[model samples]
Target: MPESTRERGRVEASRGGSVRLEDVAVRFRTKKKDVTALRDVSLDVAEGEFVAIVGPSGCGKSTLLKLVAGLLKPSSGAVRLRGEPVTGPRHDIGYVFQRAALLEWRSARRNILLQAEMRRMPADRARARTAELIAMTGLTGFEDAYPHELSGGMQQRVALCRALLHEPPVLLMDEPFGALDALTREQLNVELNRIWRETRTTVLLVTHSIAEAAYLADRIVVMTDRPGTVAEVIDVGLPDERDYAVTMARPEFARATARIRDLLGAASAAD
Candidate 1:
């Protein structure tokens, strides 16, 4: 559990946006049987906040993200952004996935501009925003590089740039760094934190890594096994001004990490 609602308040105040899920549930019916992916999952992500969801594989972590992105609909309950229910993909939401999902034929610069094109943004404004994102992700010199021409980390950076190019108010990420090597994943975590701090965009990230969840989130939402539901919500008490090395060394980091690990263990045992 969070130490207290007061501590949760301080964490929420740090992040600037609000995301709410009201008793959200998702079920899929196939030819054979029904698969319950999520159950009565309720969460609140404050404006400009960075929240990470962690759980066992197939535990509906990504399913929950898709619900928020309006890629999938719940059988019952509702997901709201600000105060509006999410009925479909919203222009105000940006999504990044496990794979960079960049086109092999397109250059990094073009990939970033793709979102702008989809949104029908003005040409000149699109170009400017694309330039800004590429620069922000440190891909300035590699603007013309194709996905195949870049490293895994670089490819993900392109995806991040693409997601942010439209300047969406909310970002939905599903294990954006899960495919990279450990060293690369750590580096990108640092880069992601920098980007989030600079943009102040509301982010809801789904990942299975305990350390990654602790390193990046203002609050960590842990879920149960299959047909997942919120098992625990932990407030990460580290200072908002964080750098990878300094923040990870804090005692609070260890405590939060331990609590999440225990929750995950309990969840697995209950399976």
Candidate 2:
């Protein structure tokens, strides 16, 4: 997530984020048999809450996001946004993946406006928003720079801005920063926290980093190895605004990370 921008001349406006999953499951049909990816998973993310989901590899962490994004349907139960069922793909939700996925020909500004163009957002408004998002993500001067001209982190920043263009209530990120170098990943984490705070976007981020989950989320949901189910949900219990250095130095941060590590280790051993 990148920081949100004000309406250029007017006051800052915030958006609501809300997501709910009820007894959801997903099974894939293969020639051999059915393979269940998720089983009996239920969760709720209140408006403006930041939730992080973590689990071992192939635990269906990303699958949960897909269900909410309407990219996949559950074998049972339901997924909802604003209380309405997500029966199909809809534009009200935003999604960002591990890779930047920018079209090489498109400049940073053009890439940010791609979503708006597809959604048929007003021309004047879209241009203004593109400018604002670029500035928000600290891409002010690189607006005209093509994807090939940007670094890995900057490209990902553009992707994030693209996802937020329409102010989607539920913003889903699947290990969006996983591919970057350690320094860049941590830097984006700081930016994301600031961005999320300003926009108040309801975020459901799936990651493998326990510390990252603790650093960014209000709650961390740890899942079993496979056929994922919620093993534990731990509140981060950190301050509203966090500084990585200060937050990590706190005894509570150590306790929280250790607790999640123990849970994940237990889950791994069980598998």
TM-score per candidate, chains pooled: 0.94, 0.92
Highest lDDT scorer: 1
Model 2's alpha-carbon lDDT is 0.86
lDDT of each: 0.86, 0.86
List model 1 lDDT by residue over 50-144, tens digit each: 88999999999998888888888889998887668889977788899999999888999998889988889999999988888888888989999
Off by over 4 Å in 1: 1-17
- Residue pairs with backbone overlap in model 2: 3-195
Worst 10 residues of 2 by lDDT: 1-10
Residue 51 shift from truth in candidate 1, angstroms: 0.3
Provide the lDDT at 153 for model 1.
Answer: 95
User: Candidate 1, residue 153: CA error in Å?
Assistant: 0.3
Query: In model 1, what is the error at residue 88, expressed in angstroms?
Result: 1.5
Each candidate's root-mean-square deviation in Å?
2.4, 5.8
